[model samples]
Target: MNQQRIDGGARRAVFAPVDNRARVDAVVRRIGDAIELGLLGDGEQLPGESELAGQLGVSTVTLREALMALRQQGLVTTRRGRGGGSFVSLPEVPGEERLKARLRGWSTEELRDLGDHWAALSGAAARLAAERTEPEDLVQLRRTAAELAQADEAAACSRLYGRFHVELAAAAQSARLTREQVALQTEVGALLCLVLGDGEYREEVSERLRFVISAVQDGAHESAREPAERCVRESTARLIALRLTL
Candidate 1:
């Protein structure tokens, strides 16, 4: 993978270990998620053990255990000499056949309910972002969206597309909102990977994303919410259609 394609500030994801319960597991999961989301590139060396532990609020021992688990899972590897540390090792994304099976397992009603919840979260984030975003913060939003639009691989686009919403919540200037959006994205991001390879769907989504960004950039708060909500709804509808085809 070309790290240069994703070399931007948005790719440096911050770790937030809420409450420190099961700290090692939390460290492993967050690092894995960062890799899956394309925020951490393949071959990117992690921070030094102590520094990484501090960032995730885990002890060095806990961090070591987490890194070992990642190594076992093939998600991270360690080196011996100078300029060496644990480095990200991204796995192949699940295949379309596997994704199709996943879609088949979910009822339309269930998927619709999840979409409704996602829409509420994203819709409000877009509205708040349009209303509250500063000129400088818009840069991150545009960068993320542009990254999604330009992503050459389905796996990369899937992660970048999802990250755009999380960035919007951050742009809204509410920490709580940002956290909530991240959590929601984490939950649904895997499902999105299933359909990202479809050129038609990907193009439509790219256009919708740009519309939402334009509305936010123009400070059209009300206009931002509709396209944002519609984007969620339309994407989920396509996924549900995939369910029926299986």
Candidate 2:
């Protein structure tokens, strides 16, 4: 297996049901969402078409069509010959104008709903992380938090910030929880890019992450949940505020 091939573990992190959906679209979404969440890295090789189709429970034809669509969108590239296969080619993050347009389309209630959903997932993950994790399990959590704190670019900060929640869920040692966190982060990660550009706000959020990790390290489940939820809610509030002003 190529080092960059998304292994089975990574594939499981984002795979979802395709039944009752257009097969091509479903395949595209499964692979596309994985890329968006960084489950698949840039220049990563995809599994062989037949193997990938089997894993996805889709026909090879459908999978081919999906890959073609991805190629057209520049999310993937396909080449023939030795050492050539489908490779991830993540596009640049959308401009602020795109983010603004996306946010302007959301209603207040929808914003709140997204916030509540995010809060619930993150809160539960944090609480479980405190209960289930050992001291060493938090190493990645601390590292991801630190990176988010120092990330100077909006896209870099947003990706690292999203990674913190994913790492927290993994520290809980629940595969289901981790996958759900990845899925949630895919959607919320894009939105976060809208607000994560501010250096001061990124630092504030980073400090909050430290507090949450500290609580988890101390095995304070309840304490961890509050700050974790607050961190998510605060980001949502910032996004909503920007939407309101626009």
Candidate 3:
């Protein structure tokens, strides 16, 4: 296995074209989410402006604008003169208090609805992966689950947790599903740190993630869906509970 091939699905997604309706924001989000999820490494150089614009089906002007926005957000850094280009700069995860304050802005109903959508996407991805993917194709999924289990902090755990589902969708071989999972994670993945921060619950979710992987590898599509959905539902329930305390 080529080491670089790991999580390639997400890398492909990060540079894929934007929705066009909001091209600048879309580019910022696609790249930003990839950085936050660790799909792109710190200090990794991005494609040149012209090449990147071509890859993303955007104009050079649009790409430059988006890059400027990323620079302002501290997600990207640019160098001048020879060998100059945009580089990834991973942002630090918010402190617990900041995370709580962010979570407080979401109503319980909103969290529930987002969870439902998340469950649907994850369940469908799991089922498709079981039916469509080879066991060997699941190495990335297994690797992500293992990483999640060993992750020492809430931020690391949340990134690996979200990465697992994204890889699951990738294993399903549905580019659209993969992209949807990426976009969805940018919205909810960080908030996951709030619940996954608990050691006990994190361990439980890790086990559930392993079960999801096992079912997919075993070709048990139906069995794969339940654990995936349950994991999301449990996490969402935890978040909602925490929100009430705020």
Candidate 4:
């Protein structure tokens, strides 16, 4: 009987069969979920492949296969040296004109679906920010808001606004929620900067920032959530309209 044996104290175990590809895929999926859920973060190093494999009950080769897939997706990078490991890559924010061009190929429904997701996550973030915010966090939030207001160009405002949302998420004090909020904000801001190329639209964004700040400042968790959701939805709709016109 040719059976692979596992050596453990007093017991040797043999597994019937295992799918290496499936195992690799599972590892990839698990890591992706961790990144999405904020269990992992950009530039954060992952555990050693051998350790991860042991944790997941798989061979190192299987884990390497999964890491390769992530590398292809530009989600993770690996370095071969002392104190080096797989690290999460930061998501890039596309420029306004570039994002607009990209969206020209997407359907209205697809854009709307993106909007819906953004709204739901952002609403939750606002509520959490209001509920958990501290004085120091509020100070940072106000500073970001002020920067957004002072920005002269759409590009500048877009970046500052994105930062404002990040600060709000930090105030929320939940690592998972903050991670989701950051992801959504990055995606939404990239798209919005593209569609909202005019001063009027940016002004609207600033006004929404004001509303968010006020709600969080007053500890109005419920009020903040709805307005944040509305802001995301409204911005999405505005982008859709712009796409239609183009």
RMSD of each: 14.1, 11.8, 13.2, 9.8
**TM-score, cand. 2:** 0.65
Task: Point out where model 3 deviates above 4 Å.
Answer: 1-94
Candidates' C-alpha lDDT: 0.79, 0.83, 0.85, 0.73
Q: TM-scores across all candidates? A: 0.62, 0.65, 0.64, 0.59
Name the lDDT of candidate 4. 0.73
Candidate 2: stretches off by over 4 Å: 1-94
Candidate 4 lDDT over 111-165, as tens digits, reads: 8988888777778888988888777878887787777767776656766777776
Model 4 Cα shift for residue 229 (angstroms): 1.2
- Give the runs in model 1 whose Cα sits over 4 Å from its true position: 1-94
Question: Best lDDT goes to which candidate?
Answer: 3
Residue 43: error of model 3 in Å?
Answer: 17
- Model 1, TM vs. native: 0.62
| Tens-digit per-residue lDDT, 162-207, candidate 1 | 7888888888887987898788777567668878888777877888
lDDT of 3 at 215: 87
